[model samples]
Target: MKNRNQSKKPKFIVISEQIISKIISGELLPGEKVPSENELIHNFQVSNTTARKSLQEIESRGYAQRIKGKGTFVLNKTEDHHLVRTLGSIDATRRGFDEGLKVEGFKPKTIVLEKTVLDHGVSAEISGKSYIIEGPVLKVHQLRYADEMLLKDETKYISLKLCPKINMLSTDLSYFKVYEDKYQLKISDIKQNLSAIILPPDDPTNNFEYESALPVFVLDSVVLSRKDAVLELEKSLYRGDKYKFAIIAHPEYNGN
Candidate 1:
């Protein structure tokens, strides 16, 4: 006979996992009513105590909010979906700076408003390399629009040393495309840092047209080539209210 003390699956845990799976799969969206304790007890044929414990577990884990009489509801996804975005593939659908905004019904438009061919030394400083940059080095300032609303402002330092005539490319085109398709440059890696800041109302350098009191997300990144050469330095600001980031973590699995 099997040991009576041997571990057995908790019925409540199984039911909780079922509901969480639905939430993660987007079938149960934020603010939707989750099945109540009574419902779970009736549907799963489990004890009322087991069902109640499961609902408490969900609320304690930040997946749902239990009002005294209003019942349990799913919490906002922003809390559950925030990602570290350290070194890995970010979800393409949630990236703020690209055409992926189309998933949210917003058309992306990048407008290059200024270009300056900086002195060779200035280019070196921005690109983190010696003055061996090929072709012409220029800085381009751009404004990004989503559905005609100013959503992002960007400043890019590009090295045309490897691919001459890159400056002549259209402003709205993706530079990643230019590097891969036009110059056939293999991207080796990218490093990024992110921060949050509130734009001061009196700050003239803040070109984005939004309330100064609102916080914005800033991203600073460097793109590298196959030989570990710095290809570009990008600084961009995104409207915080318009974007969400996601990340996946493995706590037990270690890759060697």
Candidate 2:
């Protein structure tokens, strides 16, 4: 009976869960080596395949990372930061990255790297809707730092038709704030898509100074003004090693 019950769940999953529990309980410290496959096989009396899968499972869940030729190690939990941007909300979407970092107790700084006016404008597709931002788009490239740590690299294309002479404004200021305060444009919607990407070493835009290829989160966003007019398009890269994103969800109808 006990054997029959044990067979219901995969042995590798059980082992991985135990390891995860250890991590959650603080038994495994950051940068500490995780158990080797041989150790897991010996300890659990499992086959090599099961042991390998167990480690892979832990790494997939982001609790551990594998270092080539060395072994897997726990990631730093204390420094792992999360950006809590609520989805489908105007106010939350308007909260600037600098403000978010400051709320998290980190001093934030913005550095403008490049700015140019593209007379031909740009094309973008958001939420299955196509947009052709009319000529004379202002492209702003910048880097965001949190407490002296490079956290984000971003490029924003603002429609000059909607925000003329916006390129004259300081790039260090938040575009969202500028759209609302200076232009009096109501930012009604913001659509975002997030995905994991490997930062290529040869990519010119890659500013990370890691010896190995870095993992990053790519955020593509479209900011819309009143009447669903596309105001801006943004492509931002975040350090995957240091940051995570959270979305707040609530029931549509409360059963009060």
> Highest TM-score: which candidate?
2
Error of 1 at 201 (Å): 1.9
lDDT of candidate 1 vs native? 0.66
Q: Over the full model, what C-alpha lDDT does candidate 2 score relative to the true structure? A: 0.79
**Whole-model lDDT per candidate:** 0.66, 0.79
- Using all chains and alpha carbons, the TM-scores for the candidates as numbered come to 0.58, 0.64
**Model 2 residue 14 CA deviation in Å:** 41
Q: Among all windows of ten consecutive residues in candidate 1, which has the lowest summed lDDT?
A: 85-94
For model 2, the superposed segments whose C-alpha errors exceed 4 Å read 1-78, 87-89, 249-256
lDDT of 2 by residue, 1-256 (tens): 9768767889998899889889778676444567999999999999999999999999898888776775787755565554434445565445577755543446788888889999997876766777767778999888899888888998889999999899888876667888898899998877877889998777787887666789999888888888988899888888888865655476698767
- Candidate 1, 1-256: lDDT as tens digits: 3334332657777778788888778666555568988899889998999999888887777777776675776765564332222333322211334433332224567777898776562323323434234436778899988668777788887886765777787766667767887899887766566678988756787777666566778877777787877777777787676654344455886776
